[model samples]
Target: MKLRRFFCLFLSVACLGGIAQAQDDAASLQEVAQRREAQLADALERLRTLRNDIEAQQIPLAQRLQDLDAQIRERQREVERRQRIRDNQSVELDTLRQRVSDRQRELDYISRTLLPEYFANYDASLSAGERATAGEDVRQYNLFLEKPDTSETDRLQHSLALLRDSWAQLESRLGGKRYAGEALDPEGRVISGRFVQTGPLLYFAADQGELAGLAEETTALNATVTPLSTSQNAHIVEVAQAGRGTLPVDPSLGNALAIEQTRDSLTEHLEKGGIWVYPILLFALAATLVAILKIFQVYRIRHPQPMAIHDIVKALRAGQRDEAMRLARSQPEPAREMLVAAVEHSDESVEMVEEVMYESMLSTQPRLERFLNVIAVTASAAPLLGLLGTVTGIIKTFRLMTVFGAGDPKPLISGISEALITTELGLVLAIPALVLHAMLSRKVAGVMARLEKASVAFLNGLSRKSLNQKAS
Candidate 1:
């Protein structure tokens, strides 16, 4: 019990000590709370000061921000107006550029195509004499267009001048115009001559009256004069001097002259047919020779009379074998050969006799058909040669066009015309060849048929005769 009481006493003492410590902690906490409350009051007073300062500044700040916002909106509106103006200017600029481009295209067409074409046509229309004067102007106009620094205005102005001059020249030439120019005489010397031009016709007369005739352009600027008769030359000189006499007018203009100039004799025409024409002509000659030979040979072939054949059969049937043989020998050579063979083989059977005569016909077949293939080959080869010539001509024309251009169709036309001449020659040669071949072949066939007919007639005579007397 005493121990229990002591423990209780100690517990009480510990509890009291705990109580005192708790009280001390409470006091210190109170002190801390009071100090914190003072700090809070100081903080709240500073906050009120800061709030008042901020509020004082906020009014002017807000007013400045509002002014800045108004300024920004005004600047944005001004920028929008500037942008609209810039867009409108862009449209106008594009329209003006388009107009400039369109005008440039028109200028290009005028300078490159239309004006050049006009000048070229005008140049073509100029006479050889007029070309002496107008050719310089046309050349100058061409140079103007070709110049890099030449302006559109200058080009157009020069073009107008050229066209005006060309038109004036044409009009003056239509009535009649006399000009002094250089002309190529027939002697190949250039002579100073007076030229009389009327429309498409141009004439030249040497100052000495030694040379005068129709003037033809050998080149764009050069004229070659074809001297007329001596009497006509005097007349041309008189006309060229007076400018009022009759100018010999060719209704066909230069056409008649051109035709006359192009004219060739048969020999010359054949020569111009080129190298292949020789072989073609050789074939023609060979075919012609063979045809003549064949025709003559065919003509010589026998046509045995029916009555002549009957007499031999009569003699053979009447036991006059020698007389029959004589009669057979008297027949034409082709028939005589076969008849002799048949008579020599008369002792044989009828089949043997027919075979012998047929063999004889076969032997003579080569002679009858001799050289016929040559004619046929010529007929077949002529057109091929012509076609070959045509191909070569086309090739030549293309080659010339490659070396020179096709600006002048004369080379192309002349080449084609010369090329077609070979074809013409070929057709001409082939047609007659084919016809003669047919006719000759027909004659040979007729002769062969006659031989066969004679053989058949002789064989029939043998059939009607006695087989018993054939041993002789």
Candidate 2:
């Protein structure tokens, strides 16, 4: 029994030892499991923290990307706006170019239309009438063919005055009956005798075989139903009063022929009417064209920028001498030249600067006066030329009278009318041109004076600056 008990105890101790070892192993495993679980929890926490960080970073990155997209859209809009502006500007530029081209074409057409060729036919017609009328009147007969501007009417009127003043001169020249004495009534009745200082009073025999008185009586009798009546008398008067060659008719032409020629010439003048209007229209066109050209040139020079003296002055006062010079060189004028002079003498004495400015003014004076004398001459000559044309017309009419006996007064009257019309046209052209020339000249002088004043002031201001610097 003792042996048995001892064996059992050994077994129990072995079993207990095994159980304790197992328990210890289980405790070690449990500890290892707890540590692994804590490590996993830590890993999970780290994963969650990384996820939160990523999400936060994503929000900022997304926001940044959205901002970038908005910026890109904004840039596109800006580009579009700029493009639209450029497109609009291009369209406007094209439209302006087209308008300019059309205007140029219109101007060219107008210029061609207004040329003298178009009106030459009309002038020829008027000239024909003028040629027919100049012959009958004594005044008309005297005119020279070389100069037609002095009309038959003008000559007649002049000669009539002359004849009235000195009847002896007409009788000696014209071979007309000299009535030193005697006067007749319009009814073929003798009114009185003209007192002759040297001899018996001369009387004119009337168509009724009655003696007509001279002087007033002869004039009164001749005033009506006389072959050489009012027109003839007028012609005689004109021839007597005027310069010798200026008379349209030959005083030598019989009194009847003179009167008849005057009437015929007047009739012919009416038929040809176009001559007077065409020249006037053409001249006006030419003047207008010249004015337009001048205006165009002025507009061309004045556009984009204006030459402002005030701006130049500002530049000068600022001591920006180079800028001032550049500005002055932009235009050719008294003001620019004076400004340049002042800038050149920036350091000079005030008096010296003033003298320099004065020199500039004198230099520009001739330029201001340029073409003004020509304009004045043209103004004076236009009317004279018109008068000459009228005289020529009259001469032509008188020449016709010599060729064709005065059957009708129409041509002669027409010629006289044309001469008068030409004279009037000349005055019309000359007066306005002269006035415009004077006005333009005055304006140029005024502008030049202003330039001089401005220049003086600028120089004074510059010299003052120098003086101040010296004082300093």
Give residue 316's lDDT in candidate 1 (0 to 100): 72
Q: Largest lDDT belongs to which candidate?
A: 1
Residue 35, model 2, lDDT:
100
lDDT of 2 by residue, 348-428 (tens): 677887888788778877765655565566577767767776877788779768776589776676666667767776788
Q: Which ten residues in a row are the worst by lDDT in model 1?
A: 463-472
Cand. 1 Cα-lDDT: 0.84
Model 1 / residue 49 / CA error / Å:
99
Which runs of model 1 end up more than 4 angstroms from their true locations?
Answer: 1-182, 186-189, 196-201, 217-219, 229-249, 266-273, 408-425, 467-472
TM-score of each: 0.57, 0.35
- Cα RMSD of all models vs. native, in order, equals 13.0, 46.2
User: How accurate locally is residue 51 in candidate 1, as Cα lDDT from 0 to 100?
Assistant: 99
Candidate 2 accuracy as TM-score: 0.35
RMSD of 1: 13.0
Candidate 1 lDDT over residue span 176-258, tens digit each: 88899998887778889799888888899988758899998885357889977788777788889987776677898778878
Candidate 1 to truth, TM: 0.57
Q: How many times do residue backbones clash in model 1?
A: 0
